[model samples]
Target: MDDQHTPADTPESEERSALRRVAGLSTDLTDVAEVEYRKLRLERVVLVGVWTSGTAEEAESSLAELAALAETAGAEVRDGVVQRRRKPDPATYIGSGKAEELRELVVAAEADTVVCDGELSPSQLVHLEDVVGVKVVDRTALILDIFAQHAKTREGKAQVALAQMRYMLPRLRGWGQSMSRQMGGGGGGGMATRGPGETKIETDRRQINQRMAKLRREIAELATGREVKREERRRRQVLSVALAGYTNAGKSSLLNQLTGAGVLVWNALFATLDTTVRRAETPSGRTYTVADTVGFVRHLPHHLVEAFRSTIDEVADAHLVLHVVDGTHPDPAAQLDAVRKVLREVGAGGVTEVVVVNKADAADPAVVARLLDEEPGSIAVSARTGQGIDELRALVDRLLPHPEVEVEAMVPYTEGGLVARAHQEGGVLAEEHTAQGTRLTARVSPELASALRAYPDYEGSAST
Candidate 1:
């Protein structure tokens, strides 16, 4: 009976029974500078948030999302707390009082880091860490860490590194020698400590700038290659579609379902960073290219947006944009707004957009119905179960822009390649084979129309 009454078995402590067990992310860096700007082992984290305005539920939801981000970074979440206040305290974010309370929670839970729900100023981060006596990471830093971990391609890695450099430029913290106030003269730590302290900071800043310039140059060079490929697609007159959405909203899953691209799909945030482009054919035999790009989150850092501008251009340059939203999320509308905000920033606001509410199988039926009603022309689909996929395919086919030029021509059996080109690059309105040649009527690009006119051996053809 007494054993049952112990602190570990108390109702208040039951929630700490390890729900998830994964290898903890190791935060060991080569130097203190690396520690400041490089990886952090957020192996165990305590989430803290300041509730300024929104209702209790909204605040809780925000914190819940933060918890998810931490877990994605390989952290074990032990506890989370929200403090009610007019606004985040200037010095410590959650106020010094709350920071102390958070310290208690961290110590009790044996957490090594405290993750805040909102981005913190450098001073706030330092002050809060001083009070809490543990590493403090804000929302922006946490998201950046996740991106750093998940980025796949060379360009993606460079972009993430540039963003990390941008983020750390203003918030660089120093240790021991770097923090020394050594001066050659008078009272300021005389001979022993009279070394290059401020010089160290300047040196670090210079190195960072040099590295950032190199990364920008490399990224620009890479962007050129991507643009050339896009131009090639355009030269062929293939319609392009880009998938944009909230992270974990099943965009990759839908892409796989649509084109069988077999792109890796994970249930983690920012799982897909590099843009993947694949060619797909509509049921009506119309061919269009589709790209599955990186996902967005609420309050995504501007540094990231600036760094990933070239990648985001995939959406801006696309002929159609599929904005995917997770149907099962508590606030589907919020996710929609967040993604739309990023799209607008990327100059994709003028592009044709189709809302795709995904994960319908796991989402509440009533919620799905309500969301579909709110979103006129939106399609609800379950990529896992293949529900509404046919309707979605048909809808996409109907919405895709059709070639304006219509032509009818007869080609020799030897020119079978042109006949195939008509079928692949344009919409085949009518086709008939006669002994003379195969007569074809199709709505195709001007380039294809010109090719038909150039052939002298082919029979009479007309374009309208």
Candidate 2:
């Protein structure tokens, strides 16, 4: 968690002051206190991380992402530091000496908050805040804050609130006399006073629990409504495809290009929280519904995942998943792994995936070529410029599951509606009007084939 800071005058402080001189700070030192209390925004933040694995470049890339997240949340990143460690320190996240160095850095930079790249335990959160004398926030909380800011719909707001409450419940802290409350204070005046003091924490916990219960009920009600819609689509025999990938990876752009959905598209992270479904047809005239869902990130909060289960269920139930990746990103491989991890967590791992490297227009062609070489079947496309879109559509058409039953039926004019229904729901290879009624050859679902069983077969030889 990131928080405020006070100036210090030590050797480490002097060292940080020298480092700051070379880096050249952007925000004024006097404005730090004023910026800390600004509502609806977090300004002047310092980033810190422990590099446990990977090479130096990977560590730098991760911190760069953290800086971008902070900026997206309306914070100005002053300075970022990564400490080399085998693992994160248990009490303060970074080692004690490094924590002291960080405190100096915060003071030298006049940052109001320190954002960590990973989630911190309750003890670590408290310890770090005390050492740095500022607000401390982990990656999970920052992401949740962004979600809360972007959530617009009722269900989206409910999920964000539920996730925030769950994250806050465990990290609740008390000060002053609140910590002295009695666990059981049911008695006359004197004893009751002690009881109220002891039950203070319990009361807070109870209130949070109640709110959580209410939010869960609301979310379940909303999910039931969505399920009804999904069931309706299933009954119509329309294949469903879901678009999923890292946040800001152009999933929405692709959806708009494919279906003309005109969904709100912004370059910011988690710009669209609610799911958007649009009907689209493949090149072969096969109809399907494509749904764009919330994107994934590394170390996505578990509570957030649980809260959005219903929205993500679209991916699990989909016939195909378009795993879109931003080809211009510095670390596409890591982004792919993060997205795959969330998909598996949501039980969508077994679904067939078509890797689509989007944004080819802005990406380095050499890098795109290397990625395509590595992933033999993956396709590269520019959603904005419409490059390779037709090829993508053709691929999707080819990969979609075809109907199993193929037969020719001759129905009398009195049952002409059956022939029309077949034309709508199935792949009609050929159709002709005959003296009897209508002669039609189509590839259709088993249920539709059964319904048409009573119709007389065409006497002509049937084509496969």
Candidate 3:
């Protein structure tokens, strides 16, 4: 009955219906049998999206990216469709006609899964499954699945679980046989396909709520420990710089260049899920810590931001932010916006940012030139080549907090600590060891320079 030359009750359609019927639990299985029934692999998927305003090219690219995400999560994308509309249809995402077309396409393609390009409400998901006669997932769930795959650290795993639980909270079913067991079905009679959740959807909801609370409490305890470490760094007066950029940008690469810290460098998105901090001394001998945190992507999930807030605080508290960019990405400007938007959302908007255009070796000179034109004063460097590193060091030196006053200082024998402090903390230009103490010519902070004047045995003059 559809334009695709497919009948409404074709053999393929009937097969799909059969699959879903078996996917649901039957009323004649034992608990052990029911457990076996729950573990089914999702079938091949077909993607559907609506392009409202953008050009066809953009819509196609978005759909392609969705397909890649699906494949990453173990779903094979068999076919895709994009329809133009004023906006997404509220009821079915695509209109009824398109939904029918999708069902026929799913049958013809033998696709067992349907994934929408945008976030779908619970009602939308249910309706799509009904129309397409297969399991349905939206963009949000697909993203969550990917996060679940990439999460490696304990905190990362916990955060992913929290996000997934929150996402599933609203979609909990109410009247299913799965809920009936919780209502005290003893299962002594003809309970063929009986399973644990036959009566307790409410209990399941309550348990999930309890687990969500426990997860938050655990995360909070971990955050307190993280805060303690941050405070220790603050007390040491070590300047903090955070590396922030779009996912797949060369942030980890640059971090290794700066401090010789061998953080994992990968070509995949979200490669660095945990925050790593390393110590580095600036050209002026000022010690600072640089942190590499997770990268940002466009339309990043709001729950992810909330869950990762403790980790994101690295950027929020940093004295300076290194905004790395991939000079080779075709849309570097849009990538920059994505990074900045996430920073702003995380309350790191006002941090002083230094644009670092990395991976210059692979980037076209024209692309690099255009980037500099757009973001004047950005550092252009290739971590592999060690190019422009000295210039970068000089820039960090100039940006960091410097002494207000410059002076020459001489100290007593007992003030060796102050002498060493002058050389390490202060930017000592010249120094000599003497019987009295280390006589030094340095550009030091006024406080330390003033301390030197208090010693009569020390002979030093503050610069006018």
Candidate 4:
């Protein structure tokens, strides 16, 4: 071979030229590069919203919340678009032209999903999906997905599953052969084989209904157990306070700070799904049980509210509700309204609520001051730094309903347990040791007052 063409004796310039020729041949052999197709690891989503009411700022804030919700659901939000409309388009929610624009944006962003900021009707959802050419989910479904992801406890899982099923039952669509009816077959065949059986959609609907029914029964049984526990607490005359708030508003953190519950706290939406009750003592040594329940969101799905009613009932049955708000949230007022709306829906409207501005350590002082002014009597505190906790405890102590009965009881040393019960159940105003046994003056529950009657020299008054 020639020196330039030989394997070991080729010149450097000739070798480079030969390598380039080979590369060109390889490129020519395949006009298109062999792109490896990988399944999308994360759902890429584009958000669309209609500004039906409220200012542009409010509309943008709502869209921002939807984006946060999408992120919480493990979706990468690629873009967000808001349309100014007097009302949502009955057919497409964002109207046909805006829906087309959204489709273009979604395609340009390589998004696989479109999330609407507001809940859409069935027709609207179908039409939007047809226009966007991808999976289209509304705000309700997005929140439900987040809930389904975060539910850990059995009851929590049941509630979330039930909500999802209910949401899905309406959105169930028939696609080609999946919607076909099964043909019934008989042992003898003939006309029996031609008999029509249930369609796949009907079967799915029936199965979902049956599952929802089962979940409801399970939830009812769980609710009964919770009610029994509540009854026991009532019998002991222990005041119950519930920590209620918007998702990720620091309720669990506050619960941990106040009661050392050690609840799992994360900086994500709907991090804690199950209700957690922890015993906390006030500054005056009065004991109360604080329950941290599921957080609320704006336009929370009605199915979820119904399914989680058993858990949320903790808030309704509470003697006081600490409405925790994220002080650093852009629209704390909107969050407050959202919470209040759910409270009303769950029959917790009449419950006494104390606004708690949480995340004070991270919030702007001016924002905190404004919240305090807007919420009158609202306390600003940071669960992380323990700021203003003492004041919050004192305020809780003051707000808890007090026993009206004041009593003086003299009992033998053998009944020391009853005396201790008096201290546990109500405020002990006075105590003294006497020759007979022990003299005591304490405000107690009616039941405790009745129980103290078993002792001698028991005098009761209706004044605290």
Query: Ten residues in a row with the worst lDDT in model 2?
Result: 17-26
Worst 10 residues of 1 by lDDT: 17-26
Give the TM-score comparing model 1 with the true structure, all chains together.
Answer: 0.86
Per-residue lDDT for 92 in model 1? 93
Compose the digit string of candidate 2's lDDT tens values, residues 160-243: 999999999989988865567664445555643553444567679889999999999999999999999999988878788899
TM-score of 3: 0.80
Candidate 1 lDDT over 320-348, as tens digits, reads 88889999999989899999998899888
TM-score of each: 0.86, 0.87, 0.80, 0.87
Q: Supply the global lDDT for candidate 3.
A: 0.77
Compare candidates 2 and 4 on lDDT and give the better one.
2
Q: Cα lDDT of model 2 overall?
A: 0.85
Candidates in order: C-alpha RMSD to true structure: 9.0, 6.8, 9.8, 15.0
Better of 2 and 3 by TM-score: 2
Displacement of the residue 87 alpha carbon in candidate 2, Å:
1.0
TM-score of 2: 0.87
lDDT of candidate 1 at residue 366, scale 0 to 100: 98
lDDT for each candidate structure:
0.84, 0.85, 0.77, 0.84
Clashes of each: 0, 16, 19, 0
lDDT of 4 by residue, 1-464 (tens): 73346543456633322201001100111212321121224578887787777786787788778888887776777777777666788999977866787788878878899888888889999998999899999999999988988898889999999999988998888888778988665635586576687888888899999999999899889889999999999878899999999999999999998999999988988988999999998887788999999999888999899999999999999999999999999889999999999999889999988999999999999999999998888999999999999999999999998888877888678889878877666888888777777778789898888877666464433333
- What local lDDT score does residue 271 receive in model 3, on the 0 to 100 scale? 65
